[model samples]
Target chain A: AQTVTQSQPEMSVQEAETVTLSCTYDTSESDYYLFWYKQPPSRQMILVIRQEAYKQQNATENRFSVNFQKAAKSFSLKISDSQLGDAAMYFCALVVGGSRLTFGEGTQLTVNP
Target chain B: SAVISQKPSRDICQRGTSLTIQCQVDSQVTMMFWYRQQPGQSLTLIATANQGSEATYESGFVIDKFPISRPNLTFSTLTVSNMSPEDSSIYLCSVEAGGGETQYFGPGTRLLVL
Candidate 1:
């Protein structure tokens, strides 16, 4: 069994600033994938970024990035130059091979202008 | 990213009734899945919609409760039968593109069983 944990239930960041959402998981599989998904007020889940466990380098997608520490079982998402659109519920997920995904509780991000 | 859409964006149904949510993708996909997201909770996979075969349900979920239909590669549906207040949640469908590990999701159907 796999479990994902998001310690922070809510997070706030000033406009144009940065915010980091913490996530940790427990999995015995050595090869797996980590993902960050965003669900806005529209209730549509969107993929923010993804990181492969085998790769040591972090995954960066424009304003979003991930710090994947395999040894610590930590995968945190960092949003840089945050805007109002970045305000949403972010989820951290883990998937091994072609299996189903296990998701975290989610962190609700609020960007203040 | 694949574009996905779900019908009946939100519905309020009476207890003991049923609701069917439709999921459609823009292109042909290899794998389709249904998930449930309760209020203030994370997403839990309900079943894997396999084309030309019965859906593979997850533990604690049965086909009798969540009857799934996958007639093709780009479309699927999930019906919630004998609904109750406990079944009030958002139902989302996702698809994996061409055997890819990543999955894209639909907008989700919000069901309020009253």
Candidate 2:
């Protein structure tokens, strides 16, 4: 079974600063997908960004980017120019093909203004 | 992106009772999944609801306890039978987007057993 791990239970970053949330996974499959999801107080889970295992280039979406090390099985999310709205519970998820996703325990991110 | 909605956003029920949560997707999808998130915990897969067929439940979940129905591609229902305090959690429904590995989740139905 594939498993995702987010070592940081909680993280804090000052507004306009940068913060990185670490994530690691264990998978035997060579082809898979990794994603970072944010759940705010509204309870709506939104996709932040995604990376395909076969792709060597990291995925970047505006202020969000991932440092995906395929060999290390590490996928970290970096949030730059953070804003107050960036505060939320961030989760790292993994899925091989169209199968079900395995999620990490999640890291509570707090943007200090 | 797909818009997913879950009916009865929240409900408080007595123990031993049952509650059925409905999930509706704006667009038709091939697969629908049910997940449970306990208080301050991560999401756990309950089952995969396939259209016109029975749902495939994961380990620790059974059809008798968490019965699911996927009458069509865009609609599904999950019934928590013989509910107990342990069943008090947020129930969510998700679907794969554009045949991709990424999934979109509903707002979730918060169930409270009293």
Consecutive 10-residue window with the lowest summed lDDT within model 1 chain B: B95-104
Q: Native-contact fraction for each model?
A: 0.83, 0.67
Q: Best lDDT goes to which candidate?
A: 2
For each prediction, how big is the interface RMSD? 1.0, 1.1
Across A1-113, the per-residue lDDT of candidate 2 in tens digits comes to: 89999999999999999999999999999999999999898777888998999999999999999999999999999999999999999999999875689999999999999
Scored against the native two-chain complex, candidate 1 gets a DockQ of: 0.82
Looking at model 2, residue A4 earns an lDDT score of 98
Candidate 1 Cα outliers beyond 4 Å, as residue runs? B98-100
lDDT of 1 by residue, B1-114 (tens): 789999999999999999999999999887899999999889999999889888999999999999999999999999999999999999999998633388899999999999
lDDT of 2 by residue, B1-114 (tens): 799999999999999999999999999998899999998998999999989888999999999999999999999999999999999999999998854478999999999999
**Candidate 2 lDDT score at position B54:** 86
| Candidates 1 onward: DockQ, in order | 0.82, 0.77
Kindly list the per-residue Cα lDDT of model 1 for residues A32-68, writing each as its tens digit: 9899999998889999998889999999999999989
Candidate 2: stretches off by over 4 Å:
none
